[model samples]
Target: MKKIHNYFAIVFLFFALHAVGQTKDNKWTFGMDIAWVSYSEADKIAVGGKFINQTPRFSLAKYMFKNVVFVGSVSTAIGDNQTYTTFDGAARYDFGTSQNKVVPYALIGGSFINARILTPTLNFGAGSTLWFSPKYGLNVQLLYKFSEERFSSQRSHIMPSIGLVYSFGARDMNPRIWSSTR
Candidate 1:
């Protein structure tokens, strides 16, 4: 498990750095998400019950390669007796277009997740996120988390999320760094 985590870390970092070099600037995406999260652990103290989850996310992207963009996102939520926060940096490939009025994208990235339990005796968590965004329409996702607790075992979680997105300066593959100059 450690090895797999390390490998994923390396790959995600590589892509994230590559994305930084490829983007131009002045593009941003903002969204909000509602989800359901379930927690079940053999050690009762490690996880709690299922709960409604809602996250508001914002991402900034810059064009680099033809269809590629570098992205940074942050999210926060309260759920299942805990409060969660996440930060991510990734590379994305845009498939559809602004002209078509529907934008589709795929992203692979690395994230830091922190969870704090409200109950004093329960455990909190800190972990990484390796996720893929198959559909960017309406800013919804099948959210996935690969997480580990300080005293508990590692786990993979999948949840359905629905959100709204507002994207700005999404014109070309490599949008001008300063539209004013253009």
Candidate 2:
């Protein structure tokens, strides 16, 4: 798992660095999000302890790509004392490439799962971003992770989940860069 994460991080960094150079001006988009996340768990027959599941989640993403953006965020929940960190370095495109005012983009990246019982989760999802501005918008995500936990025989919730994405940032180019253009 660590190996995959390392490789992904390396590749993502390389691509992000290369992509960032393409922008004529320095631009950034950031936002905060909150949502309900549902988790699945099975009980251990011999141990006599039941596992709890939840589906509430919260996250924030920043778009730092000229044509394609690198998204990074932290996700957390109250159930199972579980917390996850995710990095998505995917290409995002607006319908018209115009300054944001409701644009949708696709996401493709790896998610690293960290928890007590589950063997780390590395999954991928494809979603869209509805932008109100270049710096802010409503993000919708549909994600699926390959389950890798050994538990009791009983069946439980097992499927993909949907997430709400929010971005926040300034619409105007940074003043520092504007001076250089002149």
Candidate 3:
């Protein structure tokens, strides 16, 4: 209960501070996604598995340098007797290849996941954003997470997410960065 309150308060603060700190040259993106998480601990006999679940994921990304974007994402599920959550901080790089309105990017990062206990994991993923307009886009991502058995009981898992994105301070589909020449 208290944790959920803290999360909302932090999110509100983030938006207020971000709005005040925005500039014409800086690009910031906010994404909301419905993520499907597949746990590898599912029964070995079942072909489709039973550990897949859906949750909402929220992300805030800042365009830094030319190809690098720093991202922070959070997802939480509070059940009657359990709490599951994960926080990921990743650096996403945009490839030079972009076709029409589709732009692809790859990211690598670290994550802290709490299933029954808090544990650290290494994460890598690839995703793409399909822009319908200058300010709106559809975002999709897949993540590969790895953890050691010595540190945690849960093994590696894969998460796939699809959602909508809003980009602030963008020129066409690209973000403009402040430079000396400009």
Candidate 4:
């Protein structure tokens, strides 16, 4: 836990320093997330304790509108007897003014999980991003996920994650506009 916290602090500071200006174009945002996951088993299978599972996630996002982004992420669980992976596609809606340093967002998505059984999952969550500059920030999220099998009850999990995001594109482009115009 200490190591993880240190890693997060380093990433935050590195990005904060480099985040200096605003960009005007629609950019692609790439990020890496580290999460502590707690699993609630539906069957008798012992998944493991919370905080024991480390999930490293990678995500790519594009701005679809002034306040909306299309995001896709892939994640896997480590330190478990069973192999688990997930692929998700989600829409994130940013709330509050674009000039705010901290922007909150709500996410809703569908996910496909590959584990002992292949299951489709529903994800609902909310998070916030603190932008040091227009193109660089820190993102933190809490997500609740639900999956059900044909003959079994629904299984659920809580995932809390933090990460760094870097956006790439033209530096002078307006983020709120669909076209490249100042």
What is the number of residue pairs that collide in model 4? 5
* Clashes per model (N, Cα, C within 3 A): 2, 13, 0, 5
Considering every candidate listed, which one attains the maximal lDDT?
A: 3
| Regions more than 4 Å wrong, model 3 | 1-26, 41-54, 78-82, 97-100, 174-182
On residues 2-46, what C-alpha lDDT tens digit does candidate 2 reach at each position? 574466456544543443111224344333344333444332332
| lDDT score, candidate 3, position 101 | 61
Query: How would you order the candidates by lDDT, starting with the best?
Result: 3, 4, 1, 2
Predicted candidate 3 versus true structure: per-residue lDDT over 1-182, tens digit per residue:
66865775577556534541112354587877777667754521222343444455788988777678889999886432335578999998876433236667899999998876788989999998877766567889999888776764456778899987766654443333211122
| Cα lDDT of model 1 by residue, 30-128, tens digit | 444455555455433454434435443555556665666676666566433456555667666654232233345566666565655321111222211
Candidate 2 stretches with Cα past 4 Å from truth are 1-26, 38-66, 79-98, 117-122, 133-135, 147-182
Candidate 4 Cα misplacement greater than 4 A, ranges: 1-24, 41-52, 149-154, 170-182
Residue 121 of model 4: what lDDT?
A: 81
TM-score for each predicted model, relative to the true structure: 0.52, 0.47, 0.73, 0.71
Candidate 4 accuracy as TM-score: 0.71
Residue pairs in clash, model 3: none
Clashes of 3: 0
Model 1 gets an lDDT of 0.45
